[model samples]
Target: MDAPTGEQLSIRNRDAHAVVTTIGATLRAYEVDGVAYLETFGADEAAPMGSGAVLVPWPNRVAGAVWTHAGERHRLEVTEPARGNASHGLVRREPWTVTAHDADSVSLAVVVEGREGWPFSFRATITYALGDRGLTVTHGLHNLGDHPMPFGVGTHPYPRPGHADPDDCVLRLAATTHLPLDPESMVPTGGPVPITGHDFAAGTPLRDVDLDDAFGGCVPGPDGLVRHSLRGPRGGVELWADPVFGWVQVFTPHAFPGRAGRAVAIEPMTCPPDALNSGIDLLELAPACTWTAAWGLTPLA
Candidate 1:
């Protein structure tokens, strides 16, 4: 197991479950039964750990990993090699501080100051509620700075299907359009792809396709929430996310760092790729405003 790097790591557990809360508003760990549905970096790993939670924020992605704000332009250090975009927000690099902790829930907060291309300040909170089925995560962001803040919130939850083989797993999305990408840098060309390799309009089987693309135009459910889900073969386990999560990026890494290898990453987001420059319907909070979202998981099959 990789030792957590932050100084404020807090571990909580109940029965067969566990939650690792990092000051970074990160659900560093969510475990159910003896199996870890989430991925975590383990021994002999060179990439990152798995089976934990991570937070995302701020102008999610900018063209060329660069952005210009109010006569000022800043270039973010690129974290995504393919597109040269910043990819996930800045919270991933900073440690969140714990706000509250209990038997089953944990809350963390982080303040984002104008850095790189952004020109505002805000405080973000992420709360993870771990239960028997799995976990439900909630996020809240408040603009505390004088200037307006451009922001979006996201979380990376690595879940493990109880089954031994991935061949029995299926991932689904409710998106209607996908952001076309430039092969050289994975940044959006601002064009729409017909949802072919990245399409799951009809709930395609996970085994049939490989993906790492962002899609929008999702159909919101009766509750006014857009949703996405994944199921393991024997129908034993599943996960569902809220509709505010407008875009879903599905990643099937060829050889996951942990476990027996292959794993699927179903990431839900509030906006599509290049939302910063595109001015897409990103979850931006004005000065003194807050934005929030939630999702849950269960097991059956």
Candidate 2:
């Protein structure tokens, strides 16, 4: 039987290696010098908890799965039925066609045709490349229709603590604000507020805190990149995104498939949850126009 995630494409650069799957162009595995940096799953298994899945058109949850565009109300399929919200975006499970592949890089593309909720056509492409800087992922989207398109993009990558105990790892972020979510719906309640205890500006140990939070007001460093990291006794892993990504969602689930401990997901998004309704930092693409952004992971020495 074939792997549930379809083709497993491998790429390498020096001591770093990565596996990208055709399904969703997912990052199934990433490691350096034989040490795992991203929590990985088996080839026969689907992405668990959105692990390494790409989010496009929008990221996070869309309240009630409904939004109004040009005075017309659009209702998306409720993927998160229990919460009565549209979780993630439209293409997470869709198949992507490989456009390029080499020893240290691979590129895949997928087209999102007009559907019931999303009445616009667009093409999305993702390229994963490994180099001395580690792994860089670039995302491109082109509007294929005549109307303007509203969207956000992000990726779920769970950076692991390698051989060190996960509880001993420290998590850090470059964010200065936080978006509070409703306990039931898991949607943002209001606007962003000054980060307090959840402040990860200074590295915080992951031993006791449980986070399923979204942060905004990301401050880019002198390099013009917003960086987040997880460090342990052995080494560390850093995730950085371009300035276009102004929001981030960090999740720490107690249980993850193929894992004995909790896992950390650092998702860099262009907008906050329910941006379809709030319009906060949402991107609008004109007809025949293209939008591009990049984010990456680096294994620290």
Q: Which stretches of candidate 2 lie over 4 Å from their true place?
A: none
Task: List the global CA lDDT of all models.
Answer: 0.64, 0.92
For each candidate in turn, the TM-score is: 0.85, 0.98
Q: How do the residues 41-91 of candidate 1 rate in per-residue lDDT, one tens digit apiece?
A: 632322253234454564235668887666677778777766667867777
lDDT of 2 by residue, 1-301 (tens): 8788999999999889999999999999999999998999999998899999999989999999999988999999999999999988988899999999999999999999967699999999999999988899999999999999999998999987667666888999998889999989999899999999755888889998999999999999999999999988987889999999999999999999988989899999999999999999999999999999999998876
Candidate 1, superposed: residue stretches over 4 Å from native: 7-16, 43-55, 80-83, 197-201, 235-237
Name the best candidate (by TM-score). Answer: 2
The lDDT of model 2 is 0.92
Clashes of 2: 0
lDDT of 2 at 124: 96
